[model samples]
Target: MNPPYFSENSGCKSPDQSALIARHEVACNLTDISKCAAYLLKHSGRFCLCHRPERLCDIFEALRKYKLEPKRLRPVVQKDYQEPWLMLIEATKGGKPGLKIERQLIIKNQNNTYTDEFRSLYREFATF
Candidate 1:
């Protein structure tokens, strides 16, 4: 699904909207590293729109030979998952890993139960 932050369609003129979108999509779809490298040359700034700072450095290094600035876009720190506990962790890595460990245990248990139920269902269906 197209992210809500990006426009549903590329309609902006100054940004070369349609071309940018098409190039970005092509870059994202590319599987081969060589193809990705080629796509990056033509559409290097597209990642900036998504506010991916980590990717910016890589893009910069790639475009460096060409003397390209590769615009510095502001990082979009997603507020959707923001919580007091996450804030605490960000403040200190030494904080208890209780929540993360508990979540992992719950997920593992649920997955085990799901696998067992699926196996039982499969066996029952096979007899029928």
Candidate 2:
């Protein structure tokens, strides 16, 4: 359920139509996504999505507004970057309020190779 990470008004528009639609809220915004998720998920079902770190607050607020309680968060960082650029989140429908923050998921090591964790995450696609 990864919705567009950028607000329609925030970023520079891309020349490519597909990229523009995929990257920005031209079609649907976070609140729209949250509401749809709530409607589709059964009680206690989990909804997972990845979004930018800067919008974490907004993400949480939107989720909660639709009665989806944030249950887990994992920050994704690249090696050598001090700040996290992405956030992976999981929320539960009609869940109790408690957020478990997991350790950072590093995408690359200092040697510029993918981290073991990252490799394992996409191992199924390696044969391609």
Point to the candidate with the largest TM-score: 2
Which predicted model would earn the best lDDT? Answer: 2
Q: Where does candidate 2 stray beyond 4 Å? A: none
Off by over 4 Å in 1: 1-51, 80-128
The Cα local distance difference test for each model comes to 0.31, 0.92
Specify the poorest-scoring 10-residue window by lDDT in model 1.
84-93
**lDDT, candidate 1, residue 55?**
39
Screening candidate 1 with a backbone cut-off below 3 angstroms (N, C-alpha, C), the clashing residue pairs are none
Error of 2 at 104 (Å): 0.2
lDDT of 1 at 105: 9
lDDT of 2 at 63: 96
- Root-mean-square deviation of every model: 18.6, 1.5
